[model samples]
Target: MKKLTLVSLLALFMAGCAKNTTDSPTMVGADRDEHGCIPSAGYQWCANTNRCERPWELAEVEGFDNTPQLFEAFCTGQ
Candidate 1:
């Protein structure tokens, strides 16, 4: 029983060690390369204009509102 348990645990560990080559789901409506910035909400990255933009503003243009504000937001603090 102990050997079985050890083998099962080792198998699980080895399985976990296997590299996952499949691409994972990216951020909705935005990707790191597309935005040219890191993946973070709230003015972290902007793909439309290739600059930092607020997530809230991006949300505005998510569906039908493709206004300028939705493209980018220049805050003071950055």
Candidate 2:
């Protein structure tokens, strides 16, 4: 019985360690509808500034918004 419990616990722990792909967006420049507020087409949704920005622009506008880390994750492609 102890051996079975240990095996079960190990399996559960491994399962918990698995990466959750659904938690993050898919790519950096994907459509906004697909990846929430992350902008596409050389744009980024700035949460702090509460606005969109082109790559040339900084993220320090009045409504400076921020793209989710997931957006960068998507860019990294896991």
lDDT of each: 0.57, 0.56
Q: Specify the highest-TM-score model's number.
A: 1
For each candidate in turn, the TM-score is: 0.37, 0.32
The CA lDDT at 62 in model 1 is 56
**Lowest summed-lDDT stretch of 10 residues in model 2?**
55-64
Q: Write the per-residue lDDT of candidate 2 for residues 6-73, one digit (tens) a residue.
A: 99999999999998779666676555743255555666654444455453445233233445454443
- Compute the lDDT of residue 74 as modeled in candidate 2: 37
CA error at residue 68 for candidate 2, angstroms = 24
Q: Candidate 1 has what TM-score?
A: 0.37
Off by over 4 Å in 1: 25-30, 33-52, 55-78
Pairs that collide, model 1? 43-53, 43-54, 43-55
lDDT of 1 at 67: 46
